[model samples]
Target: MSIIVDDDTRLVVQGLTGSEGRFHGLRNRAYGTNLIAGVTPGKGGQDVEGVPVLNTVAEAVSAHGANTAMIFVPAPFAADAVYEAVDAGIATVICITEGVPAHDMLRIHTYVHNLGVTLIGPNCPGALSPGKANVGIIPAEIFTAGNIGLVSRSGTLTYQIGHELTQMGLGNSTIVGIGGDPVVGSSFVDILAKFQADPETEYIVMVGEIGGDEEEKAAAFIEAELTKPVVAYIAGFTAPPGKTMGHAGAIISGSSGTAAAKKAALEAKGIRVGTTPTETAEIVAGIARG
Candidate 1:
């Protein structure tokens, strides 16, 4: 069984009337996700690709039994959307919007934890269980069901590594994009813990970036808590200091969010850290084979 999503998971689009929302919603339906409903406050009566639209998440959940929500709301209002989804008892929420205000995420994060719900990302691409269900915007073509559990902070890098793994005949149990937002929902450690408990997951691939100390925290967790082999990659080797590095790339106060620091932290705990996305697959395969 996959940790986050599977074929049995039902999906709903929070901003279904919008272009990006509609595009991905349709793709999710086509890719075999159970696209049950859509939510667009003012466009309530409208239909996006035959999926019924409702004004609020509560209505959608009541009408369609949607347990998962994919939010396409703008960054400014993403927090409200997430709050609504969780308040309405949507068990899992995937917010795909980027650039959410830090304060907004902080409040929403508290709400999520309080409600005892699982939140994936406010700026993330989402999580996908290939051949089962997908909630978010990762390239569905690059995935398949297998024993490896993959999680990443970089959207495109996760896709690249997953594609490489597929090409090498190594598939994933679940691939999750924890998002790149600094204060967004979930973390490498969060996914790692879940993967650790998942029986189908034989190993984990954690992709991180320079910025905060989240990777270091995950390294510590790996050293103490996890028994499975963990292969990792942290981007932003040449990224300049003080830049956000595209999604919450872990910002340090005075130091640059450099790749060397993150790699060193993980490697110290016996976790293999890859230098490039291409090498991540090779390292994972090597670990699994060993």
Candidate 2:
């Protein structure tokens, strides 16, 4: 079983008429995700990839029973799109757009939490439940359904790690990219808690990067509550101090958010920390073998 999304997830693409939405939206549909409807203001009565498009999220909900929203609008209007999704009572909202103003996400994050809605990313790869549904932009090729649960902050790293697991015959129950933004909707601890409760998930591989204290906090949570084995890889090991990596949120301000510091914290919590993605997969493989 997947964490937030499953086979029953009825999806609506918020910017289905736009380029990003049309591109990934069709791919998601091809991966067998139920693309029930689309939302593009003034583009109501249109259809994208054979999915109906509505002007408002409420219309999509009322017409097609859409519960999950895949947001692909440009950064400028992305926040309001999310607000519209939440306002319409969407239970899960995954924002795939990047460069959204931090202040906008800051406000939306608080608002969504109070409403009990789960938001995946403001700049993320999205999520996929292999053989069930593909909600966001995670590649459907490398993933195969099995007992492992995966979460990551880097989209490309998510694919690489998933590839490693599939190659090792360690398939995933679900793979979620929580985004690399400083203020993401979900945290590593949140996804870790979900994997811990999932009976299908026997192991978890978290792909974090050098940026925030989220990894350290997740390590503590694993020590205190999780029983499943967790192997992790943190990117940007050699990233120059104070230089932002590929992601907007990947900049390190001080020694506290260094890859070294994050690795030490995770290792101290009895979690196996890998120096590379391949090594991380081997670490989990060793545990599964043991």
Candidate 3:
């Protein structure tokens, strides 16, 4: 079973009238996601592909019972959109917009955590439970429903790993790109817990990048909490120090957040740490086969 979304996930597209929103909303709906409502200011009475547009998230929740919110608003307004979704009692909110100011996201992250709401990204590709629903912009065709659960910080890497798993005939139960923003709402520990609790998730794959202590922390969580086997790959092994990498959060401030550090941490926890994405996929595939 999937953790955040499934067939029962009635979703609302926060920026449904915008270009990205209009495209992905239709795609998600066509892929069998329960996209019941749209929210766009000044376009309340309109419809995007037959989905009713509301001015406020509160209205969407009230009218359509939308429990999940997929945000495609512009970066400057992305945090406010996430705030509205949380304040409206959206249980799961996925913000796919990139370049949200870090300070703006910091406040939203704290607010969502305090409210016990699940927020996926502010600069993320979003997530999906294959054969069930596509909440964000993840390509639906690269995955198939099975036992492996994936969690990643990079969007492109998430897709690459998914493709690798699919090629190996190892399908995924859920794939989450938590975004590489400095202060994201959800972490590897959070998703790992959900995958551990999910009966359908057998083996797991975690994709991490250089720059943050997030991966090391997940290793600690894995040692103490996870029962399922996890194979991970940390990007940017050769990245020069003190430089910002591909992700907003990917910067090696010191030796603390380097790829080597993260790899060591995971290996210490008895979790396999692969040097490459394909190798990671093959390791996970082997574990699944056994």
Counting clashing residue pairs in each candidate, in order, gives 7, 0, 0
User: Tens digit of lDDT per residue, candidate 2, span 156-182?
Assistant: 888987898789887899999999888
- The residue pairs that clash in candidate 2, if any, are none
Model 3: weakest 10-residue lDDT segment is: 247-256
lDDT of 1 by residue, 43-135 (tens): 888887689999999988888899999999898788889889988999889899988888888888888878778899878899988888888
TM-score of candidate 1 on Cα atoms, chains taken together: 0.96
lDDT of 3 at 158: 83
Output the worst ten-in-a-row residue range by lDDT, candidate 1. 248-257
Q: What TM-score do all the candidates reach, one by one?
A: 0.96, 0.98, 0.98
Q: Which candidate number maximizes lDDT? A: 3
How much is the lDDT of residue 47 in candidate 1? Answer: 89
Better of 1 and 2 by TM-score: 2
Error (Å) of candidate 1 at residue 148 is 0.9
**Model 1 CA RMSD to the hidden true structure, in angstroms:** 1.4
Q: Which candidate number maximizes TM-score?
A: 3
Better of 2 and 3 by lDDT: 3
The C-alpha RMSD in Å for every predicted model, in order, reads 1.4, 1.0, 0.8
